[model samples]
Target: MRSSVVQLAHARLLIVGGGAGGLGAASKFARKLPQNSVAIIEPSERHYYQPGFTFVGAGELRLADNQRNEEDLIPSKVKWYKNAAKRLVPENNSVILDNGDTLTYDYLVIACGIQPRFDLIKGAPEALQLEGSGVCSIYLPHLAEKTHREIQAFKSGNAIFTFPAGPIKCAGAPQKIMYLADEIFRKRGVRDAAKIDYYTSLPKIFGVEKYAQALDKVVKAKDITLHARTVLKEIRLNTKSAIFDVYNAEGKPSGETIESKFTLLHVAPVCRPIATVSECSSLVDAAGFVDVDPETLQSRKFTNVFAIGDTANTPNAKTAAAVSGQLGTLEVNLKAAMNGKPLGSKYDGYASCPLLVGGNKVILAEFTPKGPLETLPVNQAVPRSVSYLLKRYIMQPLYWHGLVKGYWNGPTTIRKILHFGRSN
Candidate 1:
């Protein structure tokens, strides 16, 4: 028997996924729409501050510090559906939930964040589960503490970190953890005995040139070996080894395998779009990401639909800072579509990554397509203690209180003021 359908005709706004992006949109829409006119569909009881996971993995922050009850962050005015979205029916402007109920909305915001695919890598799932197996990942919330444990148990040998070939939530994270691990190893008196290596499928350390140059210096100074254009193929738990496939200039596998032994293996697993978003072939792009105008964040096919965060196929780095920058544009465009008006606000592709380089310092890599877009007037490429403090103290509180509450719209305005109106 088909489950009874619950029609919400008065629900003007339906935001999928209750992460930073969805919650931010919900908070904004709740102010404009009626008390029960906004709805958010999210199954998870605990909402994680994903950026803090790196710190948790580094043992600098506790796992509990990065999490909050889902009920606390979501606005009380918006109707909260503690359910998973099974499918997105754009033609009907409705979403099918796992409970077999249907939710129809006038305007939809798809923020169903990326899902980590650990099963894609051979032996990865099994390796991650085996305690003290020398395999760990900081990408998942549960694995952060495990990664810290792995780092703590490391006595010597290769401390290897692998970065996936595809787009990840935080592009800087894989390396950030590596830097933290380097510091940890040194503190534990295993630095001299261990060989630190970062194997990434990307051609460069970072996408932006300014920060990449700074990172190159750090890599050289720390004696860290960077193997670029390398993809992780398999993990041998029994031997504590990892296999890699090298890629050529054409991005094809070279059919060469490099087996490296490790006392600690940190893998940044490949990320894919959630089933609800990717299953809707009409809604996604060739890469399985929600196809939207990068600037306006409005869907090309459905005017009433918009996407933000990791789900959207935007050129900007997928981060909370990017979502914060995108919220204003998405809100303006979404509201305009409902009111039959043109989208006035535009996103400048602004994204910031507070690159933790150890030693109580961070290189704040803020950028757009045009190039290095720094918030402070000083050169942000260099590591500074102030940037680290901003990432730890200021950003955390701001994300929970300001951004998720829809009070913050990124650091663009602050950047402009600090740069004396020269900021892009």
Candidate 2:
């Protein structure tokens, strides 16, 4: 155990978590506010472009290519606190840091990202550690390369992928890897010997109707088995089998547990609100996420506090693209609150997912809570080589030079231009 004296610090604006949302929002405010007015609490030394992890698993990009030094990303004008938030005291506008320091802010931004709970599933943590155990997940940086290894080593038998219950950062990731693996299996001339299965807790293959309809066809064409309303319950590493609980369309368990053996398992483990956000009951909803108005991105209780990215309990899908969409709204609202003006800007719940189906083709799924909000004039539901090129070539640069640097505000302008100013 360690002991230290508690100290108090203050900032005009405080941001937590150095991930996509934190850096994106911080960069904008760091430039607008006075020097040292904006402060960020982040402990990690490396910042990862998590959206590229699917490509890493598919051997398209190395994990190193998707990572940058955390120090390099923080804006020069902002004060950097090499610390982690332990608790959020929103009522007092203060946050307790892991180093026994309390930071009080005039305005707060909770960008702490979601946490992947590997311990939730019995035997999962141990299974991932076992060498050649055939169990891997791309959610963690350390495990991503191992997932590629597992895919390369798999010659035959069942190749299983899973999507867990509740909201995950990228809802399509579990199956994205599955699609890429399917292409790899065919290329390696082992398609006939291998059996691919996708187990998801959702009632359908995808949430959005248009994308779901298209994905269903792709599943059928590829002869891939999809088990809907089903979730992984446990991993029997000794027997190389998994136990799953099946649910009905009504979202209730059917009291049926099925076990299947697999030669390769790619588990997208259950994700929940990180400890700092969840532990602060005042800041979170019943689901342990920062409870903010979906449109304004402002906290329901505290006017000076706001949330963005995966941490916010918004209706939009939790993706980096969603953060980019929310950035403008969050910035405007925070400024309005600071200046004592009514918040006029509203977020449309925009989010995008470049679903890499297979073989230089990607189904660019862009949507909100209502329906597909595609940027391009073409129907985004259909997989195309152009979409793949966008995901492969353009997205990474846009994320680094555009999004995190605070210049990219999503594809709203591009969408309107593509439609000749016909749409919003």
Model 2 residue 254 CA deviation in Å:
2.0
**Mind giving the per-residue lDDT tens digits that candidate 1 earns over 79-177?**
888889999999998998898888898889999989889898899999999899989999998898999999999998899999888878898999999
> What is the model-wide C-alpha lDDT for candidate 2?
0.90
- The digit string of per-residue lDDT tens for model 2 on 235-269 reads 99989999999998788789999899999999998
Error of 2 at 330 (Å): 0.8
Model 1 CA deviation exceeding 4 Å by range: 1-10
For model 1 the local lDDT of residue 155 reads: 91
Question: Where does candidate 1 have its weakest 10-residue lDDT segment?
Answer: 1-10
Clash pairs, candidate 2, are none
Off by over 4 Å in 2: 1-8
